[model samples]
Target: MVALDVVHASNARLRELGPGLVALFVGGTSGIGEFTLKAFVKNTISPRVYLVGRNASAADRIIEECHGLNKDGKVEFIKADVSELAEVDRVCKEIQKKEKAVNLLVQTQGNANLRGRDESPEGLDRKFTLNYYSRTRFISNLLPLLRTASTSPPNFARSVTILSAGSERAINLDDIELKHTFNGMRCANHTTTMNSLMTAEFAVKEPSITFSHTFPSVVNTGVARELPWWARGALKVLTPFFKPFFVGADETGQRQLFHATSGMYPPLKPAAGSPVAAGIPLPTGTAIATGSDGKVGSGGYLVNWNGDITGKKLVIDYQAEGVSKTIWEHTQGIFERVEKINEARA
Candidate 1:
């Protein structure tokens, strides 16, 4: 496990990146998202942030705290239940009209449970919609804004999604949605895997934007407490029983903030900076990548909370198993199926 200090120092270095930065954070209402927003708002000066939440009060409080921290920065509150496509679309349109560019998009929206299968009015499963598709929909709709917001030479806008990093082992490729059968662990695994696969697919299309699907390992932000009642009780009892315990909400948030601003992670980097070397070798046994676009790291990366790249071995294993291609196409099909069904009903 990487030290928290390393992550914080890297985040400190991101302050020099620039000004007029705008970040749109969905599900920033509580837990890690809320903590990350606070850390970011504190780090950047004169920043503009949009806190998207279904609860106006919570958003307003966050805005107040941000304003309190950085008087020069401005915070806008947007209310929407992200699981709903119509709401997600509306927010994107409103954002498009107002902002020419978007520097960061953080998606931490979704419920953590397997109580029952929940589907939105769009006929898409609510759990899948929030955890996976809503982020994709938001990204697709705001592509123009993201492109505009990125720095010239076109590589600045970054999207970070908070996912369970090491939960790949529980994935069920045959039933991605877990509709036929659902257990909490199994469902979380499926959602996390889908997020990883989908993030990889989107990275290919938007080479200019950097995307990271990070698993914040066992953050004790009471995030798991948001699970259904019985599950909450079980987690409360067993979480303390586990060794190498979870990090608290504040630390988890700081690590996430590090990911949000630092270009150290995959498919995204500063257009003119180099984090790796030409001829020098490193002990991590990490591979050096050269992109045709003059960008340092242009390939998609699966990252851990400590900010050091973990799960590459597992991701490669998944790719070798032929699960990667199938997963990507399945995700696209889900999006397409939803669109067709929505149109026919309309």
Candidate 2:
């Protein structure tokens, strides 16, 4: 496990690379996203960040706090319900219209709900869409900006989805959306599994860009607020039983910043002058992380909360099962169909 001190020191050195790093944080209104946003602001030099979520008041408050921390950096809040694919496209367009390059894209959207299959207007499950579809849509639509950032000669554009990376359970191949079978466990397992496979595919397709799918373990982010009162009571009563597993918000931000900017997880193709795609040069003795494909620097990584790669066995096994191909085709098909519909409507 990577130590906290190491993570902090690495994050502290982010500003050394210079300023004007453009970052977009989807679902940055609260929880892990907001924490990372604050950390990103404090560490970077005049970084331009786009904060996307439906919480305007919370976004305004977070933006205010970010400004206080780093007056030089700018945080623009785009209020939208990103669980919808169309909204994801709109947000990407807005960002693309303004920025030529996006150096960092961190997505910590999605709420794990026990509520039954809540479907969006687009006909995709809301939980699945937020955790997987919408996030990927952002990447696909914003590829031009990310590609522009990739050409920068170091640290090709990076996209990180902070979700369950280590947990890989088989998704129903027959029902990719869990339409026929939707349970809390299945929902959690399927979305994360899809994310893991999709990241590897994206890496292979866009070897110039770096992609990381990470599981943030357990965090103390007041998740009880969303649950029913009875569930909240149970959580409070049993807090001591699992409290030790929870990492505080401040430390989560530090580790997340490290994961997002660290050189250990580089793109498959190294840039000139910097062979490692050299993010913030790996802290002393910290080796480069292995990719999901079991190769060093294979462009895509499934990371743990502690700044390390998830086991390659699952990736290898899944690819052998042809799950990766299925996932890519399924996800891409949805994007294409959605684009066609949207264009026709326009």
Candidate 3:
């Protein structure tokens, strides 16, 4: 586990990195995303942030809090239901209209649906769409902006998805959506595995942008709110008893900020000799992180909640089997089908 002191120390350097950082936080109204945004506002200097969520009231409150922390910070809330692929595309386009480049794209937009499989109007699983498809769509549409950021001032761009990472299991390619084999645990596992594989593919394809799929490890983010009433009640009762074992919001925020800014995960080619990019410093006692491809700093990282590389053999074995390419192709097919359906409806 990466020490908390180290995480704190590294995050402290955000302010010293200077201003003009642009970040987009999907699902920042509450939970881990909100906590991370607050930590970032407190530590950074004059950052321009765009908060995307469904709740305008919550966004208003968050924007107010961010402004209170850094008066110079610019925070705008774009209201949208991220579960829809079309809405995800619209939000990306909106961001594109105002900004030429984005330094950080952090996505934590998902819910734990314990009842059963729910399908959206797009004929895709709702939880799967929110957790996987929508997030991937955002990245695909914003690739231009991210690439622009990669070559611009900060000279690096990062995409972080908060989900299960260390525990990647074999995905049934025959049934990616788990049509026949549908359950809460299976859905979560498949989405997370897909996340890791797709992130690896992006890393290999872009090389300029750093992609990370991280497991936040039992964060009490109210992810269970979408679960059935009985399950929600169980969580409410169990949470108080299990609170000591869980990571706090503040620490998770700091660690997330560290993941975004620190040198542990750098671009594929680090400015010739330097291990990391300009303006970012490596944390003490933390060496260059090994990528999902098994090379040190190859750009894609599967990180654990404690800010360490997952270092799982499952990841290595899957990559060796060329699963990343399979995932990319499968994801592209989903996008095409979804777009066709949207066009038909239009």
Candidate 4:
């Protein structure tokens, strides 16, 4: 696995990859997305950023902060509840109307620790809607704009999802919504699984877009604090061990920036002589490579916290049987249903 220091070196080489680019970040008002957005604006010059969030004040603060740091990049904030389909559609449509092309789309809106199953007014579970459905909906609606922003020949548009690495486990396809059984850990695992499935599906259908699902190592983001009091107490005890080895917020942001702009992860193959540095830390456990068609990466990458791309593991211990296909079909069905329901309401 590549070390963070090496990833920083590669990041230096990727300085201008994001300049003058149009990036849309959902969940950028707080947490990892916010941290990464800060890094991008500080690191890159003259970029236009679209920051989407649920809070107007937080968005405004982020924009002000970006402008204060780098007056060159233009920042726009769109207030939208990402869990809702209509809001996603509206915001995306508005963005498309304003910008001719969209260079990067980052999805980091879902929260794992939802206390209970809360269904949206549209008859979809609120957590699933935010974690999976809304993300795909935004991607589907923004494809035209994404295609417009495509860099020909070598550079492809980028799509990135911030998913926990825990997704590499067994998922019951029959109960994606987890109505029968519900808990924070289970929800978190499912979120990661959905992200992996959706990412693989996107990779297959859209070769022009680079798809990445980064499993960020533990960073002391207080995301655990957002959990139940007891869980937070438990995690607090573990923070000492986690922090030293954990990827810091800035590093996480930088790694994500690498994924969003460096064109490193997708097409599932690194070009010759590029010699990109690895991004994850050592002991980055083995990863199963997904092929260009979403099988597994032969030359495929298991992204580490440091940003290096490593070879796939000898044993893919996870149960991937039909998971990808099931996720694809289920996701598409959700989108179709959401669209029709939204249209009918309209």
Query: Best candidate per lDDT, number?
Result: 2
For model 2, the stretches where C-alpha displacement exceeds 4 angstroms are: 153-156, 340-346
TM-scores for all predictions: 0.83, 0.95, 0.95, 0.82
Candidate 1: residue 206 Cα off by (Å):
2.2
Compared to the true structure, candidate 1 yields what TM-score?
A: 0.83
Q: Which lDDT tens digits does candidate 2 get at residues 195-260?
A: 888888888888878899988878877656878888888889998999888888998988888888
Q: How many steric overlaps are in each model, in order?
A: 2, 0, 0, 15
Q: lDDT score, residue 56, model 2?
A: 95
List ranges where model 4 is wrong by over 4 Å.
112-114, 151-154, 228-241, 268-302, 308-322
Instruction: Quote the lDDT for 170 in model 1.
Output: 41
- Model 3 RMSD vs true structure: 1.7
For model 2, name the residue pairs that clash: none
**How well does candidate 2 score on lDDT at residue 229?**
81
* Cα lDDT listed for each candidate: 0.70, 0.85, 0.84, 0.67
Task: Report the candidate with higher lDDT, 3 versus 4.
Answer: 3
Query: How accurate locally is residue 200 in candidate 4, as Cα lDDT from 0 to 100?
Result: 57
Model 1 residue 24 CA deviation in Å = 1.0
* lDDT over C-alpha atoms for residue 115 of model 3: 57
